[model samples]
Target: MSHRMERVNQLIREELSRIMQREIRDPRLEFLSINAVETAADLGFAKVFVSHLVTSENKKEILQTLTGAAGYFRGELGKVLTLRHVPELAFYWDDSIERGARLNRLIEEANRDSVNPSGE
Candidate 1:
């Protein structure tokens, strides 16, 4: 990605985070975090990667809520952003953090097994 695109992504992420924290009142989004944003080259669409402390079961519900509120978010973004067109918002659950934790646990388990080959 070009430097301009990177800046755009960072700007969108920061603005979205601020909007979610101060404007949105949904209980399911209380602990939400905007991990990253990837905007299309033409600025017509954006993929918003988000994460939350809620249970995995609530992921679907959270996404639904966000999808439902996309328009509102876009409108808010328009108010704050100077872009010619505010890209459509698409929310996605970011599980990289969870995956990292699981990988760490597996690595530790492997190390433990290697240290005790005979299964003490």
Candidate 2:
């Protein structure tokens, strides 16, 4: 995790977010959020973590859709960045936000139970 790699990852994340907002027309990607980006030091491959506020019932399908659009993202990257070698894009579902929300709900439930032990 050198400084250069970190900068590259951040640039990728920002560009992906911009592409999703201004370029993509897919309905399935309307709510998608580019959570994070991780690229190899050699700039050969990248993993883009995507998250959404919507339900995860069809999470697989959503990721598959994004994977299908990887080529488009890569092309856009090539147009935007001046790097000699652009990383291959790979989409992954990031469940961190969902997990954090669930954890918060559980904590709230525990607090409620503690305050109302009588269960009225």
Best by lDDT: 1
For residue 99, give model 2's deviation from the true position in Å.
Answer: 0.6
Cα-lDDT of candidate 2: 0.90
Best model per TM-score: 1
lDDT by residue (1-120, candidate 2, tens digit) is: 999889999999999999999988988888888899999888999999988767777779889998888888898999999899889998888999988999999999999999998877
Per-residue C-alpha lDDT of model 1 across residues 1-120, encoded as one tens digit per residue: 999999999999999999999988889999898999999999999999999976666999999999999999999999989999999999999999899989999999999999998889
Worst 10 residues of 1 by lDDT: 50-59
Report how far off residue 120 is in candidate 2 (Å).
3.1
Worst 10 residues of 2 by lDDT: 50-59
Question: In order, what lDDT does every prediction score?
Answer: 0.93, 0.90
The residue-level lDDT of candidate 1 at 51 comes to 90
**Cα lDDT for residue 46, candidate 2:** 98
